[model samples]
Structure formats: structure tokens, C-alpha cells
Target: MKMLAATLSILLATSAAAAPGDADFAKGLLKKGVAFDTVKGRGKVPAYAAYLKTVLVDGGFAASDIAIEPVGETANLHLVWKGSGKKPPIAVAGHMDVVEADPKDWIRDPFTAVEEGGYVFGRGAGDNKFDVSMVIATLVALKAEGFKPGRDIHLFLSGDEETEGVTADLQAKQAKAAGVELLLNSDGGGGGLDDAGKPVGYSLSAAEKTYADYTLTVVDPGGHSSRPTATNAIAALAAATARVAAYRFPAQINEITRASLVAAAKETPGQLGDAMRAFVANPQDATAIAMLRTDPGSVGQIGTTCVPTMVSGGHAPNALPQKAALTVNCRIFPGVTVASVRGDLERAVADPAVKVAIGQEWVSTPASPLRPDVVAAVTKAVAAAHPGITPTPAMDAGASDSVYYRALGIPSYGVSGLFMKESDAFAHGLNERIPVSAIAPALVHWRALLTELAR
Candidate 1:
């Protein structure tokens, strides 16, 4: 999910090793959250925020310390757990809304959280609700235990991350005014297991590519289908989109991608792995670039990527198209301006008659400088799930609400507690889920991160 006025949005999983009672509580929270159907246009996010508020207030949080403010049809939930010492707040962030999933396309009702064969299946189960539930439950349990941190801890939940990011933009300014020192986003960054259940290094997303959507349009005078015309809007639109599809922005790299690529190279096998290493050593390696481009997983990490996602044309089949349009979404490399990406798209279209304009936009932020304390906290947390697993720094291809906070100068880290196999991830897709066994360890992970960092 990205469309920063230039690049922009998006987020999963768990297992056991800690308290089963608390794990069950988290699962309950998740099931209840899933039942709400907080998808955009549903107008249900406020109700969901109300439910979450109850979870906090019932678990010992004061009602005054929490607020549910409406943003459009959705709402944001902010909570504070005050600590004894004087320091800028340490925040934990995530989104309340999830992408739309049709009931007909899923085996189970996409909104119903179903626990099946050690997995919980639902739309937001893996993408975000899993981690969001864990964070909420952990804070509740910590409060009950009377564990006080060294500074105030805050929770910032955005109403719409899968579509527009307005909630996050507003929240970041509030966080800055409140003097937030750093943020731990539960939406991205986590450990992964191989097919054999062995650890594949944990990732701490330090940066993300910019996301934007551009609209390309062609317009012409309508005429009967029997009357052939050379300046047909539909034909011109098709050609323009085809050119955009064939276009490729130059390959690029930055601190986080460089580290992530090298780390990935060590784990990946064969020619792809070699290409990763070569590209890192020399970004201009054409052979390495070609090889990397062949794999979708490796491709976005190396450079900017754009694809035509949506299209529409004539009103009726019998009439020649009066207008035709396409929406091209792009994930731009860091340090690149939104205006620059728009310029590239305009050049690719290369048709002066074809209108090019912004369809959607969002903000972009640089890679957060690695902080030793954050690294240590995340490492210890990851170890709770997989002993000796050291998390590596990464730049996520998809943007998150964390980008908004980063734009404001607060260092934010994606330190999701869930450690899952890549094959198991299904955030914005059908029948999304996360393993049940991953829960207790995540509870442990959050507890470790909160206690260590807040202190």
C-alpha cells in the first residue's frame, strides 16, 4: 500500500513459549477485532475503537488516558501508560483498518476469525490484528503486574492504513507535540522460519520505499463503432499503459537495502544469491541487475517499480471511447522526490496528448539511523522466539504508518513480535492467518521490548 503524494501503506504471525492464558486473551482480542469488519467505507472502525478502549479500561487503564477521536468515517485510538521517570514517551503503533476481502472469495467469511488446525484465519489475522492484539494484551498484563517503566508508553492506532493515511499524518504531529522519543511499530519487521521451521534471520525495517499513484488519461470525441477513427481514446490509453508497463526506472540502493541485500544473499541460493552480492558490491552490475529483476521478491529492493493496477474506458460497447484512463502505482526508491517519480512516469507515457496527473499521494521519510538500544531490544525479543537469532536491518518495500512518525524526526522501528514462515504470510490477501504456536513467544517478545526500551 503506497501512494505518497508521491509513495505510501501496509503490514503479521505468532507461537507459544510464555503464558497460555495470556495467549488465549490475545486470541480472544483478535477474534473480536476480526468480527468488526473495519474495512474502509464500512464505517465500523469507530465501533472497533470503542471495543479496544473497553479492553484497556477493563485491564486497569484509566479512561482519561485513552481517547477515540473520529477521522473521516474511521477513528484513531491513543492510550498512555505513565511511568515514574521524566522522559519523552515511547510509542507503540499500528492500524485499526484492514483491506477489503470479499466473502465469496474466501472459504470462511473473511471477517470471521476462525481458529483452525493451529492457525487463526481471517483478513486482518496476519496483517496487523495479530500484532495489535498482542501489544494491547501485553500492556494490560504488564499493568496488572504493577511493572512500571522508566518513561511514559503510548499507543497510536491509525484508522486507515490500507487506503488513505490521513489518521497517521495527524497522529504523527500529535506525537511530535507530545515529545515522543521513539516508536515501535507492530505492523512490520519480524522473524521468519524456513520450510523446516528453522530460523531465517529476523528483520528490523529501518526504511521503506515511497509509494504514489499516477493517473494517465486519454480523451476523444465519441463516435459510433462502425466509424473507424485514428485518434481513439481507448487505443491511445492502451498504448500509453503499454509503454508504462515496458518502462523501468534505473536501479538504486541505500544503507538499509544494501545491508538487507547482502544478508539476503547469504541466505539465498544459486544465481539469484550471487546477483544480490554482485549488485551490492557494484550497483551498476548489469548481469546482477538482470538476474535480480527476474525475481519479484528481489526486484523492488534494487530500484523503483511501477505497475498499472486499475483501468477503465468507454461507457458503452457500441460507442467509441470518449475517455480512457489507467492508475499506475509506484514504489519509489528512497531519497527520490515524488515530483521526480511523476516526471519519470510522464516521460514513459511520452504522449503529449495523453493527460498525466496525480491520482494519490503520501509522505516519504529517510531511513532511521540504527540505534543500539533498539537493536538490542529487538534482538532480545526475537531471541524469545528463536534463541541466538539476531535481527538484521531492512528497508520494507511497502510503506507503513511508521513513515509518518519518521517524517516528524521521531526515530521509529518496525519490531513486530511475530516470527513466521514467508509462505504463511497473507496480510492483504484471501484467508489470511498466523500460527497459534507463535503467540506466547510474541507476548514474551513485546514484554521484553517494552520493559527494556521504556526503562
Candidate 2:
């Protein structure tokens, strides 16, 4: 009778270990509005943190293995699964914060995760929340399957990626102390789809442009509109702004970008493809450069870009402004110094009176060297999920938290398995969403990656 009781107990425990399906887990996370009001300083990150803690505990992780560090209104969740301790821990990170959205501009409430047609719509659904859900699901599934990793697996979730990324900075420090080997960021790269919604290829981001903002200010004596003169502050500011706008930074190619363009050209046919091929073979080809510039997607990949994003001149329409200012945001290419870019802008203005200053301080990280082991693992996982999909290494035009890790000598690669049609993605815009089909495949891919790398 005691033996029978033990057998029944084992069966019940096994049944309890099973986790929810991938689609269900993703839907639950989307409904939480984790990114809503994230920039307003009233982010829903705390609520999301509590929910994740519960999920981990239920998935059989010891409470001591999971740590939630709250930084101001934001938070970071770290989970550790100890293994043989023979190799450095493999870290996977994704951000919970997302850009703000307004309901008036959307077909549905931006915070409410809605399923329509074949897609799931909500803020952060595509930008990052999708990866968050996938990471959580992978952890839960691993625990339920009774798999033991050959090396420790660490999962880091940051709460301020869209803002200052304070949590990521803190996490990087901790990771370095823990002797982490490498980090695979789910928030950076993924598969690109063609116009027909067919998968073109997978991209692994090895580098990213630096994001910096500068302010151009012009000050002059106050005067009435009726007494306007050539020394008008607004006019001076406008002219300087125009000169800055007309300026174009020179085009330069790096190892990662060169490889990306080459791969992209193979997938794309016709004149555009020919141009891509020509530009790689001869960077000084004017015709090839002009042809590539016709496409907005290829423009940022080739050079540094700066554009006037915000402007403010007069305080009152009837009065000549005492001071005028405009903000020019630039994405500096790798190896370019911030000071050089600022100097270029000042020279373009050609106005001694117009003061140019860095509006915000930004860190520039060098490109990480491509790791053949990482490439092989990612390729294997991609093939397991999507047969015939080719994984290519590329650099991100925008920035991500990966820069923090890369700066600390830890090579970070963006290798997310999520695939979305380019036309269907609205990451930071209204009605942000991802296809329902994209979610399950990503879960499978992440699980495979974790198994391959950790084992």
C-alpha cells in the first residue's frame, strides 16, 4: 500500500510540472501592457516583475535562484539555473520597457493585447515583449522537461531599455563579475521578410550605431516683430538649421556591413541587387552609391546620418525670440568620434553666433568580433525551426542594450528567431503587433538555441 501511494505521488508531480503553451504564455504577457507608459516614469514593470516571479516559482525554480532588483520605478529580473559549472554562464537578455503609444491613433486600445485575423496586437508585442515571453516560456519548458544544462544559464530582463538603460548597465556589471562568457540578446536582430511575406534571411547584429543628440542655439536681443532686423534670433537659427539639413555625412563601409550587403544582394534580384554587388566590389562607385541610396533601408547602413528632430524658436509670435534652439539627432557610425561629428555640424552651420553642444552623452562601443561557435549554434537552431533559412551577420542601425555588454569585452550577438513581415511590423508606432505564427516558432527556436549552447 505504501508503494502504491509513492507511485501516485510521482505521477501527480509530473503532471504539475507541465507549463502552458507558447501562444497562451505570449498572450498573457501581451495583456499585461508591460511597456505602456514606460517612458512616462509610471511603467508597468513592477507588475510584470511580480507576474514573472510567480511563473518562475511555479516552473520549479527555487526562489533563491531568481532575483528581482528594483531600480527606482523600474526593475531587473535575473534567473540562474546551475549546471556542471564547467563553462561560463550563457546570458540571454531582453528589455521589458517599450516606447509609449496613444490609443487615439490605434484601431484598438494600445495597451490591451488583441488577437485579430492571425496577429496579436499591443504595445511591445513586436518591439520586445515577444522575446520576453519567449524567454520565459523557454525557461519553463526546460524545467518541465527535466533537462540539465552543461553550463549555467542566466536570463536578464531589463526595465529601461527605451530610456536610460540603467538596469542594463547594472546587469552588465554583475555579469562581468560572474565571469559570463557571452550574451545573446533577443532584443536586437531577427529575420527579415520580403514583400511577399516570405522569409528572406536571418540577421545577427554584431554592431550598432551610436545614438547622440545635439542642440544648436542662437541668442539675440529681444525686439518687436514690427522692428525685425537681419539679426533676428529665429532667422539665424533657421538658416543654421537649413545648412545642417543640407549637409550629408560621407559614406563608409565596415566589415560587418560589407558582409550584410553582400548577403542581401544575393537574396534581392534586379538592378538593386546589381548595385549592392557593385558597391561592395568598389566602394567609390558613384552610380552604385546613388542606386543604393534610392532605398531608405540601405541608406543608414552605408554612412553616418543626422537629422533635425525637434525645433523651438520664438516664445511669442509678436516678439523676436531672445533665444532659439533646435535638436539634431545623429546615429554615428562605428569608429567615428562624437567630437568629430559635433565639429562637422558646427562647421556646416557656418555661423559663429550659433552655439552647438552635445545635448546628451552617449557611449560608443566597438563592433564585436564574430564568433564561429555562436554562428554555428544560431545556424543550427534556425535550420531546425525554419529549414532553408540562411542566418547572416549584420549590424543594427539603431542602438540596443547589447552595447553595454559589448563595451565590457563580452561579445554580444542579437540572434532572435522571431520572423515578421516588414510591412506588418509596427514596433514603436501605433497598433504594435506580431503575427500569431511568429510566436510559436520563436519559442521553438529559443529552446533549441539554449539546448545547443548550454549543453
RMSD of candidates 1 onward, in order: 9.9, 3.4
Runs of candidate 1 with Cα error greater than 4 angstroms are 1-21, 102-105, 109-112, 220-239, 310-324
lDDT of 2: 0.84
lDDT of 2 by residue, 296-327 (tens): 88878888888999998888979978999999
lDDT of 1 by residue, 1-455 (tens): 23542221211022332332378888899899999999999999999999999989988899999999998899999998888766668899999999999999999999989999999999899778989999999999988888887898989999998888899888898899888889999999998888886777899998888888999989999899999788899889999999999998899988788888988999899999999999999999999999999999988998889999999999998999999999999988877877888889888888987998876766777788888888888888888767888888998878799989998998888999888888998889878999988888889899889988887
Query: Which TM-score value belongs to model 2?
Result: 0.88
How big is the positional error of residue 203 in model 1, measured in Å on the Cα after superposition? 2.2
Residue 70, candidate 2: C-alpha displacement in angstroms = 1.1
My TM-score estimates for the predictions, one after another, are 0.86, 0.88
Best by lDDT: 1
* lDDT: worst 10-residue window of model 1: 5-14
